[model samples]
Target: NDPLLGVPIPEVTSEQSSSMASPQSNVQTNHPMTHHNNKWTKDHPLNYIIGPLSRPVSTRLQLHEQALFCYYDAFLTSVEPKTYKEALTQACWIEAMQEELSEFERLEIWELVPRPDKVMVITLKWIYKVKLDKLGGILKNKARLVACGYRQEEGIDFEESFAPVARLEAIRIFLAYAAHRNMVVYQMDVKTAFLNGYLREDVYVSQPDGFVDPNNPNHVYKLKKALYGLKQAPRA
Candidate 1:
């Protein structure tokens, strides 16, 4: 199911379907241009590059075709809005921002207050991405609000950062064991998981761009929990 749109996937006919069981049957062959035999003598400049004798020509042409095929859906995510104003120009982006902000509010991630004179407030930015299915179909548009942690001074804003991440070998071993046991692995993601981490440092951030509080436009948010892009977020 498509999470963002909630639209049912369109059914494909058996002839169009390509699965492990019948991979060779669905392989693309007999291109239209190849059948037409466009004029290009062996000695011609174009023929020298893409003639039947060119070993890499087929690979290069396939790559070009794949890139052209992805052109439409790639724009759905590869082109990201740089600012809140830019994002508002698109309805899908606006909805994605709203959903992210609502999640932050529900988690009680921060408190709005007057900015302290001496403290430096970290800036926030929006990031956009498109989620795809196993078969490379667009599934959802995802938006994330992240702090500009790169601007953070090392000793002042953070002490140390570390997080537990799986190693490839360990993952492979686990998968092998699972397969040996004839078990299915179930995976789940904790949405906004970073917000659940406790923040030890006194971190303050500028209000999120699009969802600023109307009553306190000048105020900043004092973070009680770790935010995405914070230096200590992964460790916290």
Candidate 2:
């Protein structure tokens, strides 16, 4: 009787079952628990334990198990870098930084210029992050070159510090309205958000570490758009 092919097991006779059912009965019953030996699978109440079933696994079942393991293996993710120095040493982090710089250039976030006299040039730092999917698997590595906005003066760098953010109640109301109208809701991801906001103040920042140009080592980046760390970035 093969278990893998769903073959039915041979049922014991009613007379043999009655003898095995009684705990006080001393009569022996023909219950084939062991394979041709009485060395294992004892019928004692104290020592009675179900043993491993001897079954044949088909080739298809073996392949399916292998495929299941491979599918879950994709969720394995790498660790995030702690600093720019650590990030520069790895190829994956270098690619992430490159992607960030490319987006900045595409958006015309800053322009290269000589260091202005008596001007406060903010230093930039590389922020490393591991972007993950909903299932917790790594989607990609994220790098952001952010300005030191803490050095910014209230009136000089920014005026009003405010960003329009939706409230919890407003979100709930919107969801309720959408449900009432039978709307199909979809999420839109804004990759480079603050970088797209136009900057009113002339914010100058040092070139990103590890990617500093040899030709313009003393040059600073005059920001044309809002930076990540800027107080007025979300407002802009």
Q: Whole-model Cα lDDT per candidate?
A: 0.84, 0.81
- lDDT for predicted candidate 2 compared with the true structure: 0.81
Candidate 2, 67-107: lDDT as tens digits:
88777544322666777777766677898889889998899
Task: State every prediction's TM-score relative to the real structure.
Answer: 0.60, 0.62
Q: Which candidate should be chosen as best, given lDDT against the real structure?
A: 1
Highest-TM-score candidate = 2
Minimal lDDT window, size 10, model 1: 50-59
The residue pairs that clash in candidate 2, if any, are: none
